[model samples]
Target: MAGLVDALGPILELMTWVGFVPGVPLLVWGLIIARRRCVWTRTTGEVYSAGGFTGFRWTDQDNVQRQTLVDADVARGLVAGNEVELHYDLCHPARWALGRPKHDNTVLILGWILTSVGILCTVGGFVLLLF
Candidate 1:
């Protein structure tokens, strides 16, 4: 058991790099995008269902019609021509989402967890090296 543990020490230390390298960047990018999404334009749209898929359609400020598929949760209880709320980027009308845009914490949480693990591993590695 001790021999196996000793053999894996260096490998575990190197694996920490895998988490640190991507975690910080993911957290930063998630924050930036979440912040930007907070300012998207809000409007009322209509839901539509076709063939086994559900989506919504709305007109942009330019009066151009736009449509995109929605997730099951968003499509629940909705039917064709049902009115729904939507959020969209003013600069890119095609970029839209159901409901008001808010900070999606999924990426942020994952990034934080990975980064914390990496930091702990690094600190422990250094402590072990010194002692």
Candidate 2:
């Protein structure tokens, strides 16, 4: 029984580490997506559609000219010289672009999942060390 417990301890520790490894990136990305600001603006140029994507230029806050692109679904109804709001990560202004519509529940879901996994792994690792 002692040998069995010892063997199981290492396996559980590995599993816990594997499970928690993704939590950091997931949490960071989730926060980045969550805190992004969306601003409404009118397209200043023609929207070109190609290869299932669309692109156009627009003015953002600070009156600076910027370009944006969106996938098929959001692009379908957009037209040249049309008004649209862009969701962009403030921390990565150069990557200004469109993103999916905000889902209130997604943040909570990701936060909980990542936190749980990270905690579980850290706890499991400690438990293994003790065993």
Candidate 3:
């Protein structure tokens, strides 16, 4: 069998660009959302389910209705009409998050680290090819 690096070289190189391109924005948004959430106002929102999917609905400060899928397991006993504390985006109140998503953050941070290392490897690989 080929060496592990040789087998995975192309994948690692491509993933570097892919993760770096999207991961940067996702990481930034995750961080910004996390920081803003620190001061999110407590609002009474209804958690609803239909067709095997669950989501939350609430009205923002501007009185605009908003809805988002709830993926964070930080809260429990989520049923219809279960009042929950939600965090809204300061810039866009319609955007919301139930609570801190550790898994998501860990993935974002890991993607960044891996992408950074991949970029270095790609540069070295290119240099080796040229030489």
Global Cα lDDT for candidate 3: 0.66
TM-score of each: 0.46, 0.40, 0.41
Best by lDDT: 1
- Give me the displacement of residue 32 in model 3, in angstroms: 13
Model 3 reaches what TM-score against the true structure? 0.41
**Full candidate order by TM-score, most accurate first:** 1, 3, 2
Best by TM-score: 1
Better of 1 and 3 by TM-score: 1
Cα displacement (Å) at residue 33, model 1: 1.9
TM-score of model number 2:
0.40
Candidate 2 overall lDDT versus native: 0.61
Error of 3 at 53 (Å): 0.6
Segments of candidate 2 deviating more than 4 angstroms: 37-111
Whole-model lDDT per candidate: 0.79, 0.61, 0.66
